[model samples]
Target: MSVEAELIAPAELGTSVVSDKGESIAPQAKEAASGLLDQGDAMTSLAQQAPSVVERMQDFLLVGGPVVWILLGFSIIALSIVLVKLWQFALLRPESNRDVTQALALWRAGEHGQATVVLKRNRPVSELVYIAMRGVLNVRQDMDLLKDELERVAALRLNQLRALLRPLEVIATLSPLLGLLGTVLGMITAFQRMEAAGNQVDPSVLSGGIWQALLTTAVGLAVAIPVVVIHSWLERKVERVAAVMSDSVTQVFTGQQISVVAEPELEELKRAA
Candidate 1:
């Protein structure tokens, strides 16, 4: 009887352990399933909302009329120009200082070959520096003529940077004016409708028209403000590049002049001695 009781107790202990593990695993499984369901629900809600958001934007644009469409075009153009200019600046690296400084130092040290190699980068400033160094060493041209050539090249480079800027300025200037025109036209149409309605004039109708008319001005200003700021910022960048080019080129010439003067003075001193 005692042996049988011990064997039965062992079986009961094993059963209790299995039951406890099962209870713990069941809650964990339920939690995992609930979390997956929550994620699926969120994804489904976002998918549904996406189309509605797009529809709202389309409706808003339609309500703003032709003027808004034109503004949208201008905004696209401005964005494209901005992207293109950014790409150009990145490729050209107009503000690169380290290589320019190194090249200038090499030039001043009379390592003309090394200076030319250092200025081999495909940058406007580097090009100008190389040309100046070459003109002094190889061309042996008069300083004045070389300076003139440098000036011309600098102008050409600056003009390249200034490209597409006029269109941006035009867009900024014309946007607000176009919006005002749209508002005027819209108001006139609303008034004509009110006159046609005579004594049955609805304030809601007038209010809707006025708001729609104002929408053009709002869109126009939105397009113009950022464009103006961007145009100014780009102009500043170009100006800075111009300054760097001028400074670097001037330093090269100035170093040449000092060397030239030193040579004559050194010869004169030797003769006097």
Candidate 2:
């Protein structure tokens, strides 16, 4: 019998068997069972210790003796802001670089109505383009007034883009200072103890106290660095949106000018015809 046949039939559980090809089915079965048992033991160990792992993290964050539960609070706030911005950015990402370029090409070609229709199809960069081109369609509308309205709308969109960013900026600014304050407090406490001990102070105690004080500074930096990075990234996204608005508005104004200048020539041609 082949090893495969032996595995499927397994003549007897835990019994020795030699395949017709002289392969040892017994050993293979034993090894497979051993692997399964090892995996089971590992999973059981993890299941048993899962609660302790969470408990340990909770205890450390809550009791990591040093300067600033307030620093921890700042970290939490920064994290919340980061997450919210990430979600907002993901939803509002500018998705039509090529489509917008094509639509703008149409606008510049003196096809203002068709350009807006093309932009409408893109769904992302097109909204601003559509809004700008709306004013272009109405020739009697003052271009400057239309431009001013676009700016106001752009400002509101930008405000929305940067909504929670202020909190992140605040967190990045204050975490280090809070950490430094903690370090100072820790050093003061250590020195007060040394003074109280009056020549009997242990060197180890002083060293331990100094390190405890430094821990706050380390954690504060850890929180601040990532927050600064994320804040800068979010700011860049806002700038990208602004750039899109500017580019689309420029296209609208160009199309308007082209259409406006062409009108008198068309009338002259009509009179001649």
Candidate 3:
């Protein structure tokens, strides 16, 4: 009986030891696995966040680029000038074809006052017709004197038309030079910054200065191109008007009904002015 009890006690002790070992190892293994899972999650979060940070930086540069702002400013000023000049030219048409027929009718009717009234009422071409009519008014008008006076009046009217266009020429001439000056200044600044940074400088550190340099050049061209185009168009319009005035003056002088007679008083008046 004593032997049997001792054997049973040993078996029970061995079973209890096996159970304790399993309990300790199971909790430790679970904790290590949880730690690995948390580390994987943190790594994935960092990977996703990195692309977002880079994309934000790219967006900022694209929108706030210096070149875009410079171009915008150049376009606004140049286009504004072009639009105003276009409106001015539209308003400056020569006297209508009807004016020629109407003036001839007034001359044939032997009513000089009504003819003068007709010429005066028209605004744009009034100055040209007014000068020619003055020649007709003289009792002794020399053909040479009449020709010279009409030419002078035509030139004066053209000068008035070209009054404000000098600024357009100035902008066309100076814009490129101003851009070059800006480029030179930007380069100097960039070099100074590079020198200060020494070996630590990245090439991208000079990107702002480079952007400024390029933008100034582009802006200069933007202003110059349209000014040149509009200036040429205006010059052609002036030429056409001058030709029309010349033809009209020639017709008036060559008409046999209007005789040319030389007057000494008219010559004196022209010389005094």
Judging by lDDT against the true structure, name the best candidate. Answer: 1
Query: Sorted by lDDT, highest first, which candidate order results?
Result: 1, 2, 3
The parts of candidate 3 lying over 4 Å away from their true place are 1-84, 95-98, 101-126, 257-273
Write down the lDDT of every candidate, Cα atoms only.
Answer: 0.90, 0.77, 0.68
Q: Give the alpha carbon lDDT tens digit for every residue of 78-120 in model 2.
A: 8778888777767666644666777778887776667767664
- Per-residue CA lDDT of model 3 for 17-51, tens digit only, reads 99899998999999999999999999999999999
Best by TM-score: 1
Question: Candidate 1's residue-wise lDDT over 1-273, tens digit each?
Answer: 699999999999999999999999999999999999999999999999999999987976898888888999999999999999999988888887788899888887778789889775578888999889888886658878888999999999999998999999999999999889888888988898899999999998899889888888988999999999999999999999999999999888888778668888999999999
> Which pairs in model 3 have colliding backbones?
140-261, 141-261
Rate residue 29 of model 2 by lDDT: 80
Q: Is candidate 2 or candidate 3 better by TM-score?
A: 2
Candidate 2 deviation (Cα RMSD): 8.2
TM-score of 2: 0.74
Off-target runs (Cα >4 Å) in candidate 2 are 1-59, 62-67, 120-125, 258-273
In angstroms, the error of model 2 at 144 is: 2.4
Weakest 10 consecutive residues of candidate 3 by summed lDDT: 253-262
What are the models' TM-scores? Answer: 0.82, 0.74, 0.55
Worst 10 residues of 2 by lDDT: 13-22
